[model samples]
Target: MTAPSRGGPAEAAPAPASAKPGSRMFASLAVRNYRYFFFGQFISNSGTWMQFVAQDWLVFHLTGSTFAVGVTTALQFLPVLLLGLFGGVVADRYPKRRILLTTQGAMGLFAAALAVLTLTDVVVVAHVYVFAFLLGLMNVFANPAIQTFVPEMVGPERVANAVSLGAVNFQSARLLGPAAAGPLIVVIGSGWAFALNALSYVAVIASLLAVRASELRPATPQRREKGQIRAGLRHVREHPELIRPIVLVGFVCTFGFNFPTLLSGFAYNVFDGGAKEFGFLTTAVGLGALAGALMSARRRSSRTVVLVGTAAAFGALEAVTALAPSVWLFGALMVLVGLLSVTFSTTANSLVQLHTDPAMRGRVMGLYMLVYTGGTPIGGPVVGWAVQHYGARAGILACGLVAVAAAAIVGLIALRAPRAGAVAGG
Candidate 1:
């Protein structure tokens, strides 16, 4: 599909050609528009990670309840479970740049508000829950805009590269955010983490402001229509390849992706540690994930076998990690868990985007994000219960077993379905 016409400037501007398809791992960075978006979002994403670590740490500290941490996480994703589809429709109908600005600015405000509350020592656990849910509401729109915007910034030929590199950006930030938050949490308070996150959004806003509209290969805006949401779902239902990964990811993630819940429990209970220890464990996962993302960037295709295999390995590793007798062993095992988990995620993301038609891209990605992200909330409290009663070790073991089962089930289904040819070029 061709990008929507930008008229005068577009006519004069050079074609938004990408680097030699899969020849380079960072090919998408060659595109000026994508570079601005990437580096800016990198800064913002690191801050988001900081908030995640601090928020959960604070909640765990406050209630001294594993279930409380789970509940807080569940609240954050509840909006995505409920209103995610409508966000897709909005993404299709509006300019993504505008949606991003509005969402980013609003998020910064929420972070600043949280910071003020925490710094003044007036904050309650309820305040964090409210902010997390509010942030999810923004993400419902921002995620679709961000996910679908990649192909526009760089052409279709560079989508896979862009996606992988984007994962690299995120995972690398994971290494930084938690490690930095560790010391920050000790020196002053968690309030400073929130404050930095609010400031970080400025980088994103400025990057968006600097983007050259004419350089963008924007999609044709979908007109407002009554049955659009329904139509989008039907589109996915009719496509087996799309539906398969979406379902598989939901299952694996629902049980296996409760990292914060599981890790926090381990830090507080099993490992008998504090914020710095929690940060160390989380950063270990990020270290492995960064490696996984970098390796994924060098490849060209997203295959079902790879996705299923990674999920299986990730689950097995999580089970082993749960049994670690020492913090050192747990951290070491977590790196493997992080690596395999990220591989599965990047594969699923690449497969969905590569297979969908541009017209339905936003809506389809919305559904994908709904399942991918929404699964965590449904599982968090349940997993927390296992940790609360059985032990943190039990929670991780349960997640591993479930992920393995899901992979086996999905693998059998994939064998019976029509052949899935790998998406090449991009």
Candidate 2:
């Protein structure tokens, strides 16, 4: 929607409108659309992370305990687990750009409302929980639309680069958002952080509105049908390439990437540190992930070996990270852990998007997201219990082993299925 050229916020509005929108300008506008999305999403993702940190801070301030904070998080994610499939159905059945406009606008409004509530001294923990749920409810519909919209901006040929760039945006925000939030919270309170976050949404909204309809190669919207959701599920089940990466990612994420449990456990027990130390380790991971995302952008396509091999490497390295003799060593290896983790994620995401029928991409991607994020609810407590009983290193080691095993199992199945198909055909 605009050009600040990554230098200042004031220039973020008003794009060059001299060129008439037509087929001759096709290539330029397509590239421009992708840029708009990338820049808009970059700002939006940062605000999201800021909102997350501020929300947790507010909850703790209100209740004076972490229990309600944990509950707030649960409320936020519960909708995703319950209604995410329905979100995919909506994505397939509607124009993604239109759905995005409504959802993104809704989210920004929610943030602004929350800011007003908190700043006015009328806020409570329950209000935080409610807002959290509302934001998540919006995400249920927004996420699938967002994911499937990627190829439309750049065409199918550049989907991998687009997805990798998206990952880079996320990791950069992951590093920066919380850093910004802490200072905002200390200086002006959580309300200001929330307000700033609300303002950030303008970038995305403006970009979405500014898009030329002729530029995007959007997937043909799936028509409403009785069994669309079930049909999407069946579609995924039938595709080994899609299902294998999805399942591999699910295992790696659940067991290998239980950050809340594993990171906290190691931070306190192994390093004898606190929140600052925890943040240091997290930053290291984010840096590595950012680098990995950059490296992934150069690749033209996703492959079976890269997807499976990265998963296996990610798992083994995670195990090795647990054995580090010092914090320096641990943090260094954790950087590699982050790199491999994002590489596998980007690969898995691209592979799924590139292979799936555009008609069913939304549902398949939705299932993929459910499997990836859904692991935390199951794995976090399990890893926490393991750390409590067996110790942090042992818990992390087990997670790593689980990742390697999942990768190996999926790799075997993928290799065998092709031969199995040949025999069945004969």
Candidate 3:
């Protein structure tokens, strides 16, 4: 079948060939609803990152176990592995804005509950586990909805730009949140960080409310039917272009994106660093990711070469990072890793959304989020165990090796396959 039109429901006339580069780079923000969503995500994602740092640190403090940290990460994503497809189905059948409002509220409540527990000094490892699981459950629903919602805001012509800008918002928060968390945890304690995160949700909720409902280029809701989930599965199964990149993402995300487990180990164990160093490590990655996002924003299309090439580069950087002799050197490598990571992710994301039918976008993205994040449950524990026994370097090395191997394999398959041009076309 031919690819879906890149123009969306509210798609505007294309810019002229002589249009300025800056206009192309910031094309998506021309839509009013996207601008509100952008600023709101900027604030909320930063708070989310702050809580991430605080939560990991608190778990380590409470248990003094890296395995516990992995478990926390696992609990947070396990629900996505289990229920994400259903969440996509829900996204397909419902208004994404309404789904986001409900899911965002639930997540805020979970953050608030964690904050209360920590503030009262009654928080324990088990409490963190439970709350992490609850948060994961909320994400299972929210992630796919949010992913599909972006196209509705900007229309398909600018979806790639919008996705890259979303990454800019996220990485901006990633840079700020952990940087702030280190000092905040030192001075005020982790509980207040959680409280701040809970309050940050207000920004997103308000933005969702502020968006003009009539302005949204909403997708046609899928009719209720038996075997809907299977239909989604079959759609992906039959489409090599969609499934191939997603398969590559699954491998990379499972093995390559375990930075929480790896960086935590590096900070506490290898570098003999404290909360500040850990925060810096994360911030370095965020900085690199921001650069990558900006670069991706300039691109008009996603291509298979960009996706596979960046994945390979990311893996090579991870391997080099494992062997860095100093904290500064390791942090520097992390920036490169972050840059490659965002490049690969944004390219893959745009490839999937741009190629799929809008009616099926939610389910495809649901699968995308599932493959992207849901593998955490399996990889997190294994990486944590490697760090605990084999050392942080070994754990990082393992991740790099797997990612490189996956990229090589995917690249080889893509090159050797018949109709490679058709499959690799973005």
Candidate 4:
């Protein structure tokens, strides 16, 4: 199959090439390949979210320890910290579609293992820890491959729109998954939720098989060389636009995005709620994220001000949520927090992908995932410890304060360097 040319839309006639810049909200769907990818991810992400809720609940139930919950979260992301750079090298050297197929299958198998253990009534906290680490190993490769695959489906012209729409699909699943998981766990069982998640992988694998190979715009495969990882690091260090946003994300993600630890602590300890209430809390955040992602889709371009401003608002909202007097009030504030978080994350993701060179995109995204997710190993333990000793409220408050500080520090740096601002705005 012939890859799409890097030139004009005239080179590829399979997709609707007439989609103008004015109608970019769903512009990536004009390509048949992206349409398949979109629907596949929708179903798959929903299943993934269901598993997330079920796993958290199961761990808490088995241990009744908030620190155990944090350990689970940390184990799941540890591989990204260890192998993320190597994963990027593999993504740039191999076919992403093939890599996704392999990794998705491995993930499904892991989910099946968990379901069996739970159904047999023989599952323990140690089993959960082992499975989470294995899944993280798969993600070390899958994350970078998935991140860099967006451009191949829609080409560079619609990359920003494609990225935003991807978020919409993910957040939409986030909404559906928790909503269903709560009732399903109540009526059926947590094991069945894992079974359903395993089944959902079939949809994504089928979609991968159905995509037209000829429609893809694959990057030139990178040659094997020494110091490739260092080269990727140097690339980001030299590019102020990329480095600044990544630094901001590293702080917020490391200190702020410990929701699993925070929410689990809040539901069980603070709110004194059950599984159903925990599900509701997550669903509320998902709804807010969906709204934010839709708003981001309408934007023509991502800017520095939007990224920094939304992050600041998100931090303030999270801080206030820690002080809510009732579960309903806390849930309400969660909506605003979710909205701002997605807005900042989606904008930052697009900014990094759009500005970086195609050949180096995978490596850069590998580093992005490293910082965005790998921090959990460090932050989860700290947040979990705080929740266990102090209170859920205090743990969440610490998250908010750190986010606000990071945004402020990055904002001040940008102001001092006019050229960095220009790069971000561009």
RMSD after CA superposition, every candidate? 4.7, 8.6, 3.4, 4.2
TM-score per candidate, chains pooled: 0.89, 0.90, 0.90, 0.88
Candidate 2, 1-426: lDDT as tens digits: 321121111111112345332321222224888788778988999999999999999999999997687788778777888888899899888999999999999999999999999999899888898998998899888888889988777666556667888888899999889999999899999999899899999999998888778887777787888998899899887777677888888889988988767887888899999998788888888888998987776554567788889999999999988779877889899899999999999888877776677788788878888777756667777887899999999999999999999989988887887631110000
Residues 186-215, model 4: lDDT tens digits: 888899999999999999999999999988
Number of the top lDDT candidate: 3
**Model 1 lDDT tens row, 360-425:** 778888999999898776787788789889999988998999999888888888889878536642
Model 3 scores a TM of 0.90
- Full-model lDDT for every candidate: 0.84, 0.81, 0.86, 0.83
By summed lDDT, the worst window of 10 consecutive residues in model 4 runs over 6-15
Q: Return the lDDT, model 4, position 196.
A: 94
Model 4 residue 360 CA deviation (Å) reads: 1.0
* Per-residue lDDT of candidate 3, residues 90-125 (tens digit): 999999999999998988888999999999999999
In model 1, which runs have C-alpha deviations exceeding 4 angstroms?
1-23, 57-69, 120-124, 265-277, 322-325
Question: Whose TM-score is higher: candidate 2's or candidate 4's?
Answer: 2
For model 3, the stretches where C-alpha displacement exceeds 4 angstroms are 1-15, 61-64, 122-124, 267-277, 417-426
